[model samples]
Target: MSVWRRYLVKDVTGRLVDLPSRLFDSADDGTAPLPHFAGRCVELVAAVIVGDRVSHGRVTELAFTKLYFDQLGYVDAAKRERMIRLMLESCADRRCGSHRQDSHRQGDCSRLAHRAGAARDQLSREFGWEPKPDERDAALSRLDPARLRAAHREPAQTLH
Candidate 1:
């Protein structure tokens, strides 16, 4: 019996690009680049979370964790833990600068927070990778209410 799977990736332009199953088959046989395929998977998840919008770095980290969880079979426990640490560190780093603030709106933060929470829950439940209290707090803090309010208030300045 043959099992078939279909994959879709979101391009930088936000278009949903369907990846051919043959690409996976080729990668399995060493005829295609695994890194490229993995990069596409990351891009796919990132696109789902942020669409065409420019996202905060933490948003991308959450998306990466989501992708990793979705394809747990491909990742070992050690690597998964490392990725989790990297995600938390990236999220906890507060020097995100003005680009992050300029890019995200309130709705974007809500979506990112929702997805990050889901990823955290799945990590704890399935992988036995419980995040530290500070890490958890840092992840949640990425969805700053002040930043959301600032983004919300920006439109008012243009309302003249």
Candidate 2:
């Protein structure tokens, strides 16, 4: 097991990009402490903001949860709910794209888009916002084959 102290730093939440980078670093260590876990929370917030424009919210969220679990190991229902709610709020403005490049070959591209669209709608409803159907579809369509493959190849736990 690798020592995790090198990833530790204090009073850095206000720095946006540095936050996620720190979180990403800590996540690789399996023994990050509670305060470092708190830092990961900061990273999650900043990541939601930075990734909003680039469609990486889900990716960041997965990492956030992993570090959260690493720090606390087990959180009760109330705390877990609060964290999830915070995540949803931070990412409320972002859209997730699930464009499928293999759809044409498999004739299942529409299904992929539909599933992604439905997930988006569920997120919007949970956050008390109307889902933008057309905009989401357009965004998915804009995802080129290369991007889709990259997204698909990402860790399954890294987000949708």
Candidate 3:
């Protein structure tokens, strides 16, 4: 197991990202105390931000949660702004349930996408990563082909 993978724990919350226990203080190494990401959790925050796909709600949740969990950006108004912008850029889907849940009266889908894209310029500097051209396509391309392959290709594996 790679050192990084050891600290990686699947979120029971059912979102598709691997969260770091060190950041959340959920690391359970029996040998000794693990370093916590109380104030320097930039990488973990980036990973979560990157993992945000398919659901605008998840991005919104991550954005709000990072205010406390990620020590690097919450204190800066600009950083917080960029995070909001990213969430907005992720809001192109008119059918997204997250838009309906916004208590702020931001139910307009195109407006949401516009708001999210507002922070594109600051993404790299703030989060140490930037979206690629056609970023959604890139996100889709990251899927593991093996996991998506048909499982019952062989006759014995078929129910019939």
Candidate 4:
């Protein structure tokens, strides 16, 4: 039998949601698992904010617990820090979209920004990860919606 334990996060309606067990799988060389877990956490937070799926506060709480307290064996300090950075970037992206020129999407994006910011702050506080001065500015610039849109206008590059 596998030694890994299943993890759950509570939704907005107070229902328990299962997180994939693969997220907790350790690397074969005894290294901590990679940043997929962090990406998954960002996806969950985005679902709650953009898709209106769950309780943002509760989900973030459990996310922090999973990343910091619960899965320390599978995720090391570096991984946890990377996860926190991912959450921060998501927040910055949502916030930037709020300032877009499209008025129709502005209101929705503003609401999403607020929700994402709350989740981001909660995770930062809980995980004790803070972006450096340069990183704070870099995160915003990197996720700027206008820049993202311009980049997507180019032809898609195919991977070999």
* Top candidate when judged by lDDT against the true structure: 4
Query: 1-160, model 3: which lDDT tens digit per residue?
Result: 1112212222334223434445334322222222333344333322222232333111111211233233332233445566677655544443445534664545465565565455443454455432333332222222322211332243322110
lDDT of 1 by residue, 7-100 (tens): 3443456444554657544554445544543433333221112222233321222221223312322323354576576456434323332354
Candidate 2 versus the native: TM-score?
Answer: 0.25
Off by over 4 Å in 2: 1-24, 34-107, 120-160
Q: Could you estimate the TM-score for every candidate?
A: 0.26, 0.25, 0.26, 0.28
**How large is the C-alpha RMSD of every model relative to the true structure?**
18.5, 15.3, 13.7, 17.4
Structure candidate 4, residue pairs in collision: 12-55
Regions of candidate 4 where Cα sits further than 4 Å from its true position = 1-100, 129-160
Q: Which stretches of candidate 3 lie over 4 Å from their true place?
A: 1-35, 45-82, 89-118, 128-160
lDDT of 4 at 79: 53
Q: What TM-score does model 1 achieve against the real structure? A: 0.26
Ranking of all predicted structures according to TM-score, beginning with the best and ending with the worst: 4, 1, 3, 2
Q: What would you estimate as the lDDT of candidate 4?
A: 0.41
- Shift of residue 40 alpha carbon in model 1, Å: 6.5
The candidate that achieves the highest TM-score relative to the unseen native structure: 4
TM-score of 3: 0.26
lDDT of 4 by residue, 1-160 (tens): 1122334443445344555445434521335554433333221211111212232111111122434322433445565676667576556644454243777577667776777777677665554423343332232232232333443587632210
The whole-model lDDT of each prediction reads 0.40, 0.35, 0.34, 0.41
